[model samples]
Target: RKLPGAAGAADEGAADAIRELEEQLEQATQSLRAREEESKAAEKRGQALNSKLRRAQAALAQARAEARRHAEAGAHQDQELRDQVASLSSELDRARRKLKRAGKRHEEDKADKAARKELQEDFERRGTELYKMNDKLREAVERADLLGKALAMQADEVEQLRKHVGEADEWRAKCDRLSMAEAAAAVG
Candidate 1:
């Protein structure tokens, strides 16, 4: 009876050891599967970050290109505006000088106005005197025309008187001849 009891106790101890070894193997398998899942998640996160970095770099390059083009255009417009301002400033200066000269001339003309007025009045007075002289000369020419007509009539009267004198002389000579003839007849 004692030998059988000892043999039975030994068999029970060996069964307990086999059960403990199986539990240990199961725990190790569960731990290895959880580590594999964590590694896969880390790889996916890295891939997503790389894609975002590429997109950001492309956006930055595009923005730089646009900025450069705007700066160049702005510079060109600024230069054009500056040139226009310079041209307008020069024109304004020229206009101002011309106005100043004109103002000086106007002041000089105003100062001489009294002398100019006196000369104008004298010229008008002389013109009136000359007009009266011209009227007198016209009247003298009319009187000369009348006198010339009277002289022509006097010359015609003188010519008629000379013809009458010649006729009288002829008659006187005939009378003298007749008287002499009569005296000779009486003597005979």
Candidate 2:
């Protein structure tokens, strides 16, 4: 009975150690699975960020190309404008020289034109003088009319003076009759 009891106890202890070792192994396997999931998520995020960087680089290259094209077009336009300005300047210089020669010929014509202008001015001055003389004649006619009216007034005043002299003679005769009557009364 003793030998059987000892052998049964040894078997029970070995079974408990085996059960503990199995629990530890299951815990380690769960931890390894969680770490694998985290690694996969990190890899996906890295790929997305790399794709965004590539897109940004491509857009930057396109913008640079557009800027270069604009610069080249502007340079060509500026060169064309410069060439046009140069040609216009040369044409202007030629026109100025031709105008100077025409001006020299115009100077020769100016002497004849100046003589004609002087004759026209003399005629204008004579016409102005005639107009002034006509104005003076009109004023003289007005003065003659005024003098004729004054002479007519003087003639009317002379007739009034003659009437006044006749009235004075009549008054003198009446005064003489009154004086004779007064003398007769005194004598009687």
Candidate 3:
């Protein structure tokens, strides 16, 4: 009877151990399932993070490319601006030269105008002198005409006086002859 009682107690202890082991195994399996779920969540989060990182990197590369393009455009604009400035400077120099030439031409025109004015004044003075000389010449011509008329009248009067003297001489001769003849008769 002691041997059977001892075997029965050992069998009860073995069954209790087996029940405890089964409970531990069930708890471990539940814990492993929870861990596997957590691992899957972590993998999804990592993939999301990698996708976000790739997108961020792509955006950064695009931004860098845009910045390089903008920089190149700015350089091109700067070069164009420099060319424009050079062109403007050249235009300004040409304009300044043209202005200087125009100023010189204006001075020459002023001088020419002054010379023309002086010539005009001289011509006017000469014209006035010529008018006065013409008037003097007309007066001299009128005086000469009057003197010629008076000289012609004096020549006609001298001719008439000479004829009267000739007639007087003939009459004197005749008177002397008559006197001489009367004296001869008385003597005879």
lDDT of 3 by residue, 90-177 (tens): 7555655675678886755555566556656755665565566555545555554554554455445545544444444444344345
Q: Write the per-residue lDDT of candidate 1 for residues 1-188, one digit (tens) a residue.
A: 22368787776765566465445444544543454454445445445544544554455455445445555545555565456556655654565567567787565555445445654565566556546555554554554455455545544554554455455445445544544554444343
lDDT of 2 at 76: 62
Which stretches in model 2 have alpha-carbon errors above 4 Å?
A: 1-10, 104-188
**Predicted structure with the largest TM-score when compared to the true one:** 3
What is the TM-score of candidate 3? 0.51
**Tens-digit per-residue lDDT, 1-188, candidate 2:** 33368798876776676565555545544554554454455445445545554554455455555545555655565566566556655755565567567787575455445645654675566556556655554555555455555545545554554455455445445545544554444343
* Shift of residue 161 alpha carbon in model 3, Å: 99
Query: Stretches of candidate 3 above 4 Å error?
Result: 1-3, 102-188
Residue 163, model 3: lDDT of 48
lDDT of 3: 0.55
The C-alpha local distance difference test score for the whole of candidate 1 amounts to 0.52
List per-prediction Cα lDDT, in the order shown: 0.52, 0.54, 0.55
